[model samples]
Target: MTRTLSRAACIGGGVIGGGWIARFLLDGTDVAVHDPHPDARRIIGEVLDNARRARARLISAPPVPEGRLSFHDDIAGAVEGAEYIQESVPERLDLKHEVFAAIEAAAAPGALIGSSTSGFKPSELREGATHPERIFVAHPFNPVYLVPLVELVGSGPQDEAILDRAADILARTGMHPLKIRREIDAHIADRLLEAVWRESLWLVKDDIATTQEIDDAIRFGFGLRWAQMGLFETYRIAGGEAGMKHFIDQFGPALKWPWTKLMDVPEMTEELSAKIAAQSDAQSGQHTIRELERIRDDNLIGILHALRANGWGAGETLRAMEERAFAQAHARAAHAAPDPAAPLELHRAKVGGDWLDYNGHMTEFRYLQVFGDATDAFLGHIGMDADYRAQGLSVYTVETHIRHLAETGAGANLTVRTTLLGFDAKRIRLHHEMVDGAGTVQATAEHMLMHVDTQAGRACPMGAPLTERLAALAPGQSALPAPDHAGRPIRDIGWPLGEPA
Candidate 1:
């Protein structure tokens, strides 16, 4: 089944739970939410709006139809038919236990339960529970829809299957499911965060740095390194010809030196809290919370795109998701029997804000990207796939001519209507019309393609279904009227000799 997430229930719809909801729904999972907060619906709606914008920019895959969103009066109603349940209520032992009881009472049998607790252990959350084995920690970072990591922890060895299943479900939704080996008080990331937080508080309390200055230290320095490579991995490079052991040997003793006050947490007096709050306000007071979130989302998208180019770290995860999305699209197309007689519509996509340039229309390069994707979709329509390419035969673009017909704005839903101009044994001449949702032509491209034996690095005749499929479609496609500019090149606009000389 392609549906990894059929239904998900969120017990709380604050920032974290709201993110979980958006992540699930945008991945095409129906979600039911329960929160007693009077403004629960509005809060979730606002978060969903932000998530929608971020996803449009962050992911280029035409999003699957969003899953249905519903709010329930109580937790029981929310968890009724849910296959996955995430709890993100306020942190407390008794409250969690009570919620777990309510959830387990009505949740489907064997449905997975994950707690978003930052401090409580799985063992603690499992206490007095009906299905204690099902409960585990699925803690995520803030702005959870965009940040992919969900630190998964179980109490002991009993949850290997549960962990694997949970990880699979998360991976399908484009999340990196990191399984923790053992249960600790706050799990892995939060523990590390606590250490950093303690040191930062001390820095602030001693007036060593203002909030902005402290933030600058991170944003300008190791934070970038930490993003793609974590602490030890980044430091291994710091060893310079030597490795981790050498770096540790050189810098390990510094750990023993009294250069930090990690153990001694500063007292949380009224004065210190006020000082920290005032400094934070002064530093970022110009932007509202939502505005800051948008900036962060944009920055994260840039970083992710960079990492994806290199195929390292989180970028690898993103690439895998993109591959999966494309494969799914191809699969759906393959299953369908679209009329080969008509203009074959194999691909469509929405123009997100990221696709726009300074002129507020889709950028120049993205048009080619869209046409290229449509070309792939066409190849897939004729049964080209990874398996076929593995045989060292593939299609390559030899030449292309594009005419920008109209300026398309952001949020325009684009559909590529492809026509087969002509074809030979080794060459396929194709034409593509890029149209917006309203049927206006935004652009058109004429491409000459050559099938090649990848290993031989030369043109080759296509075999089997590809040729057969093309022959089958040629009858109808060949009869269609050709565009006047199909074989034309850019018009020469040489300046008049006398104008400037």
Candidate 2:
């Protein structure tokens, strides 16, 4: 939806790189990927499938058309003509240097190069680079597409501009790009995670808690709080009437109470590794890795939806993305806005797999959703937008009639054709025809929409822009023949004719 790079190159096809590919492609940027693994294509395909499912559920705004995907066997072929190149090979510095060299040789001159290195600083990543300024650290958490936090660490003062540009690009693609002030090993989030990881390993080695117990301690406790508020804000609230200062005063002593073994290095002996692995296997071995990924994605989608509704934390990023998505959809439909003489075809959608009912057809409610979206599109076509709504003016649908004409299935592409039957100073009567890809009418909806002053909670007379626009189109639309079903009400059938008598 946001203006993305013309082309993006991913130098690896493992989990993290594949996630980058998914985000870029779904945001409507052509992606070129290079991965040497024997089964790279299959692995990337699986991740993409999951990403698509997540996108369908998580995004409420109009969908962006998916971009092209191409796989290359070599870095030179992949990075050619790419405006943004991401390196996600193994963590070894030597391997990264080789990859960077190849990328530098073939990538476009002004391409932004980012490394998905968790522990390496940007300076270390740029050690032997030809265009060092273009290279930086863009560390992301696991399941990069859904989680949305991208730690963008730049190496020097010159890198400020580049990192800012990188942040802009990522933010447009529905990510929160946290720009680090300076280069540091392991960056920010991972450093905090490492402390907890070390302490958890100690807790297990001491037999104080099993793997499942430790996970429950986090997931059932502070993990929920951290998802929305993070550490400091949650503690600030715990301060009650006092503030963060009081919280620090109360817990500062705990920092030296030897409550954690964060500084101690646990010898990862074969026995210790096996003990942890076996406990983890027992805890979650019921599901395969793919199944577990899907479960995680679904949970994250729900949480994101809640956060979006509340407009808090990472949800703000999601909100911004949805806004951009709406704007982008409006821009795409700009060309399709018909002359008042012709029926407007401004809304289109493809039924997702999640839209199906138990009967293997599209669910009843989804039909309503499509028609509602179509109505919204028609409103937007005239000039309604966020700024217009901010003036406490909006059109509310007062009545509607629907006729289901045919069964709809998952993945069925639908288009809505709308006609303005009549409009007074305050209200509009509109009709929508929902048709499938084959041009068969699937459903029809008629609605009476009233313009209202939201703050006053009452219907109001129309103003300049809306009144003028409506008047301009009234002649053409009013003169055209109206739908046969227009203004019709539900017909009554006598109880089986003679049965009731």
Candidate 3:
């Protein structure tokens, strides 16, 4: 029997490290923590609780089914044989080198080693390491469990493969991994954000704006747009007629203006620091950091949850999450995969005694048969019926792809979701993801259908009335193909279909 790689190790066990542990464990990966502090386990447990609560807002799916956590007193013991090692110790250069030495010695040679240093560049962190190629910066935002972005930067060729694997694992943990083109201090996002931080510090030091006011400026203004689409793209739309170049041409001269003092560093004088700290305390005296953390979590959940509805970035995260939850629930209930939530109408055949083959599960071809029935039903619902076909109007399947993931044995009741991908004057495209009642995706179908005129027995344009009707149905889905299937096919599967429907 082959064992799944679900265990990971975190070294140092401080705030950020504890967060990495929380994120991994909450995402269904068993985690081991290594920290010399005698209170490491307690601290990590608290962090995980916070992380879990924060994750609650963003993920509506069931809890990650909980995973085991082990505390290792020894660093080598924690890293030994682990598939991935996340090093999140304090960001001191010397300390990172010291820790990496041990990590290199203990972690499996093939294991990816990620250093959670917000300040140190990958080259600098891996300077003295024997496994330089395997060590890279995996800088995550503070409060790692809530934030979805990770900045991956490294120099060596092996770094790409390791980072790609890390991206998969991070996606599993519900994070967005962006691989940086070059090794730079503070990676990508932090660098862009650092400029604002520096200016915010200046404003505070000069008494130009209150912290709350700066926050208000962001929240009430461009912040919301930036959350969905970042700076350049947002600005390009704002540029009007000619787009990006026109906008740049009009605004390029502003770059030379003294609107920003980015190069100016703020002095952390005792008086200035004291004043800032006092103002921060005054601004949030009503709540503790724990309370603020809860608020942040709620906001993240709201924002990401809303985005998930549209199948955006954070929304995709939610879909991925819901799939896992549905999968786990089905496992526990020992039921077959059924239909997930969909906008279109769907139906499924219950698993009968004869549905099971010699392996005691539904066979592969049964998926096609069931889905074919579903397609027929859906087309019938949407003005495509025997009469319409007799008039030379029908849907032709141009392409299909199915995946078998799990087995649905005899006596297992199953359901499916059929979604209208889009429709045009000439053709219709549809997608179906079959899941259990618990919401696990079992199989998916992407179908390209051409409307045919029965009299000519060939493809024909869809009537305006029918197109208008479909517009009322799928809405915006008709404009373009989904991001995953752009310019490629009439239809293609998005999720794996396990066994049978």
Candidate 4:
């Protein structure tokens, strides 16, 4: 199993399959998709579009160049020479068996085949297959492009190395692959989800709550808690410092109190189906499915970003991936020298829809965030890297003045340029310009940074390495005139206070 997977085959192009394609492609793996659905291309395109937008907003580090995507009408054509193959056809066992048989015939001997089946066990999916060892369930949550969790189930005499290879491949695509210890009907997460889902259905069947109400109860309450910390850990906190044992002792009795109808399932009669459908429609029918998807992606991005900031759960995964991306970008840039004629163009990003305000323009705080990232890049380029900070020496921003020159909207591509204005041992002044794709300035920022001995909590002289690099950049940038917006006083007007009146 190579760390660098070049090509992958997707055997379906519905929601889950498209997500697999989007995740693979975004992570720089070329994808070949095979699907017989007439609307496969259109559905996958929509998913990819949402994926691209969400990914841009979710991570700030330089993205890997997206891999080429090609659609194939036949499974053999798609799976040929593919290092990895993911099957996401309908949930029917016979259909999956047919698809797996076709894939096994054409797929390379070493290629790992993963099925996106939520309900079927890996043993069942591998039944009657030539290479059952290579066939396993790699179940993923909906909108798989954004969610990081992928359940990996492998329970056969097949090569153990093959299972490890599958995990490696999924990790490379920015997923947290949880290996199932044993084969189960639905595998861990879905089983837990099914229990809750059954309860929610019972509530609707009893007319105690509508679909939206059930959703609201989850999203507004435990869902937020679950996102960051799972059930047991959350309950551990509920023990009031006594710990899990105490909490379980207190709440364990309630488990048998018949609070939930976990053993019972509501019959999906026509009346119940129509009731659920009508309620769902009335709750969310204002938006089309595509619109709802965008909304979901946007909300997920916000939640993930917050988690990333805190380095919790899925956020931890995202942060790790971002650090890897940043390091890779820096490594690539290290091979090339910065051009003296141009300001260092190291940071690039697209304005996310979440950054917009009521006026439909990028808000103020994001401007500073972009500038800060550019500054960090400049620091990394000048030998002020993680090791430098780890040694208790770093530069801290002391002052900043930002000037908004032009309005930029969501999805606008942005490029940042960092100019060394002035520098000495103790402090450095920098000017950053945020420009759009057309090379028009959207905003400008002037920052003064103080070199600090972080442990001492005071300003300190920078090391010779950083000083030398700054000296090199300063001379070239000094030849250019000071920006007109620099050093402008914060005032209502430049003239005398009463002159206009």
Every model's Cα RMSD, please?
A: 2.6, 3.7, 15.9, 3.6
- The residue-by-residue lDDT of candidate 2 on 1-501, one tens digit each, is 334677999999899999999999999989999999999999999999999888878886678888899999899999999988999999999999999999999888999999999999888888878999999998887788888999999877888888888988888889999998888889999999999999999888889999999999999999999999999999999988899999999989888897877778789999999999999999999999999999999999889989999999989989888887776675565435478887788888889877898999989998888888788777766666676778999899999999999999988899998888888989988989999999999999999999999999999986666777677778878877888988888776567864543
Ranking by TM-score: 1, 2, 4, 3
lDDT of each: 0.89, 0.88, 0.73, 0.88
Rank by lDDT, highest first.
Answer: 1, 2, 4, 3
Q: Name the regions of candidate 1 deviating beyond 4 angstroms.
A: 1-3, 390-392, 463-465, 491-501
Per-residue alpha-carbon lDDT of candidate 1 for residues 352-442, written as tens digits (9 for 90 to 100): 8778999999999999989998887888778777678889999999999999989999889999999999999999999999999899999
Better of 3 and 4 by TM-score: 4
RMSD in angstroms between candidate 2 and the native structure over all alpha carbons: 3.7
- TM per prediction: 0.93, 0.88, 0.66, 0.86
Comparing 1 with 3 on TM-score, the higher-scoring candidate is 1
Please provide, for model 4 over 1-501, each residue's C-alpha lDDT reduced to its tens digit, 9 standing for 90 to 100.
237789999999899999999999998889999999999998899899999988888888777789999999899999999999999999999999999999999999989999999999988998999978889889998899999999988885453677788888788777898988788899999899999999999999999999999999999999989989999899999998789999999999998798998887899999999999999999999999999998998899889989998988899888877876676565555444778556878788788778999999999999998898888777777877666778899999999999898989987999998888888879989899999999999999999999999999999999967887777777778887888777776766535665652
Candidate 4 accuracy as lDDT: 0.88
- How many residue pairs clash in all the candidates, one count each? 0, 0, 15, 0
For candidate 4, report its TM-score: 0.86
Model 1 compared with the native: what TM-score? 0.93
| Strongest candidate by lDDT | 1
Model 3, 1-501: lDDT tens digits are 112348889997777888788888887777888898878778877787778656644543335466788888788888877898899988699988998998888888888888888878888987878878888888888678877788888885657777887787777776778899888778778788999989998998889988888888898898998988789889999899789999999999999998887989889899889988888887887998778877777777778778878888667766776665544432332222222233453455555444457787887777787677566656545555434555667678877766665776665556666667767788887876677766666677777788877678788898644566566666544443453532354344444554332
